[model samples]
Target: METGTLYIIGTPIGNLEDITPRAIRILNEVDVVFCEDTRVTRRLFERHGITTHLKSLNARTESLKIAEVLDLLKEGQSVAYVSDAGTPTVSDPGSQLVGSVRNEGIKIEVIPGPSALTAALSITGVPASEFLFLGFLPHKKGRQTQLKEIAQTKRTVVLYESTHRIIKLLNELEEHIGERKVCIARELTKIYEEVLCGTPLELRGILENDPQKQKGEFVVVISQ
Candidate 1:
């Protein structure tokens, strides 16, 4: 049997309109799709009228689903893997599955699309020719150490933060980074998309007084 290919497809981070035509085509053409959330992918599929079969392969079930994906590939069935949002393996699950498939000499293809990391950086105006992308920082344990390192690092640093902890993270940045220039991009590609540029303290004050700005995912870019 011919070896089936694995398509690492990137989907929209926020706005559905950000999805590329090729991504939609691959989603429609693939035999099966392994996604972080079946419900989320289903909504995307439904939006584009794609009826591809989707199975969950999030962090919780990534290990358990690897064998199933391998079995399908071995049977000459192409599979597409996608994160809940944006590109796979960008602080999302897909690395283990891709690594397992690669070891067996299976074909792997990447369908690029929207990524919050790049999206935030695009408007950051910070020289990001060489920068460190921390993705999401640790909630505890090494969190302090990581913050300390970020504070000392000279390179532009980018990280993702959740709505709930964004204010706390901003405060932490103010403590460690000490008035460093920070840019927060929230709800990228969405109708309410916003990018706030200022020192950690200034942005914290904005988010603190305005409850609405506290909502939605955040991409933080700290300049050197």
Candidate 2:
């Protein structure tokens, strides 16, 4: 039997309507859907009224499950891989599975959709002719090293930061980059979506005064 194809589907980051028609069709037609979190994907599926079978495929068990997924493909079962949000393998997981499937000589296709990084960059009006996406900074060890590396980059830099460490990261950036222009995109595509632009020091003061502004995931953009 001919090997089945692997579809890397991209889902919406926040707003459900952001999903494209092609993505919904593929989701409904695929024999099985592999996602980082089945529970999260289930919400999307339920919202769209899609009832396709879903299997959990994340960094934790990707190695153990790749063989099984490959086996299913060998049996001519079409499968789709999706992350909890946005495109799969963009700091989410599933790169190993894609590599292993390609090694097996099976076909793979990417179905692009909403990405928080691109969405944040586009709306921020920050020049992104050349930019670096440092997915998530190290939590402890080498954290300073990572910040220093970002500081040296001549082009714009984008990073994903959690609510807990955003203030600390801003302080570090201010210290190393010295009042560089910065943009913070928080709760993107949702009801509370906010885009704040200012120097690192300025943003720090504003966030410090309004503690509520510090809540939710943050996308930090720094201009060189």
Candidate 3:
């Protein structure tokens, strides 16, 4: 019997139209789909008219359910793994499962699609020949240490910030990197999508004055 293949699919970050046709076909072709949030992924599948059943798989539940994935793969079942948004395994839950499948010599295919990191970078106009990508800062512990590091790094820096912490993150960026040019992108590919360019202090004021601007996923790009 042929060994089953594991598909690492990249779903849209915001707009459902961002998903590639190949990604859509694979999601439908796979025997099962595992994602970060079924409710969120369901919207994407529903938008594309895909009826594949979704199973919950995230950072918290990865360990508990990875064995189940392995068992299915060993049984020659083609499986697909996706994140709540963007590509899988970039600050998502597919790292362990991908590695596990690779160690067992199972086939793995990456279905390239949307990525927030690349989306923000494309619109930032910041020189990113090479840049440091810090996915998300630690909420409390060592947060300052990371900020300090960001202050000194010569390369461009990219970081993801949530709506709730955007203000706090901007304050830290201002405190540490003072006057460094920063580009903030929110709601990529969505109706309210916006890209703001200014110093952290300046952008913070903009977000504060307009409550609507501070209400989505954010990608912060710092110039060298």
Better candidate by TM-score, 1 or 2: 1
- lDDT sort, best first: 1, 3, 2
Best by TM-score: 1
How high is each candidate's TM-score? Answer: 0.98, 0.97, 0.98
- TM-score, cand. 3 vs. native: 0.98
Better of 1 and 3 by TM-score: 1
lDDT of 2 by residue, 48-126 (tens): 9999999999999999999989999999999999998898888789899999999999999888999999999999999
Cα error, candidate 3, residue 115 (Å): 0.5
lDDT of 2 at 138: 88
Residue-pair clashes per prediction, in order, are: 0, 0, 0
Worst 10 residues of 3 by lDDT: 88-97
Q: Which digits, one per residue and each the tens of the lDDT, describe model 1 over residues 1-224?
A: 99899999999998887888999998899999999989998989888999999888999889998999999999999999999899999999999999999999999999999999998999879888989999899999999989999999999999999999999999999999898899999999889999999999999999999999999999999999
Q: Which residue segments of model 2 deviate by more than 4 Å?
A: none
Off by over 4 Å in 3: none
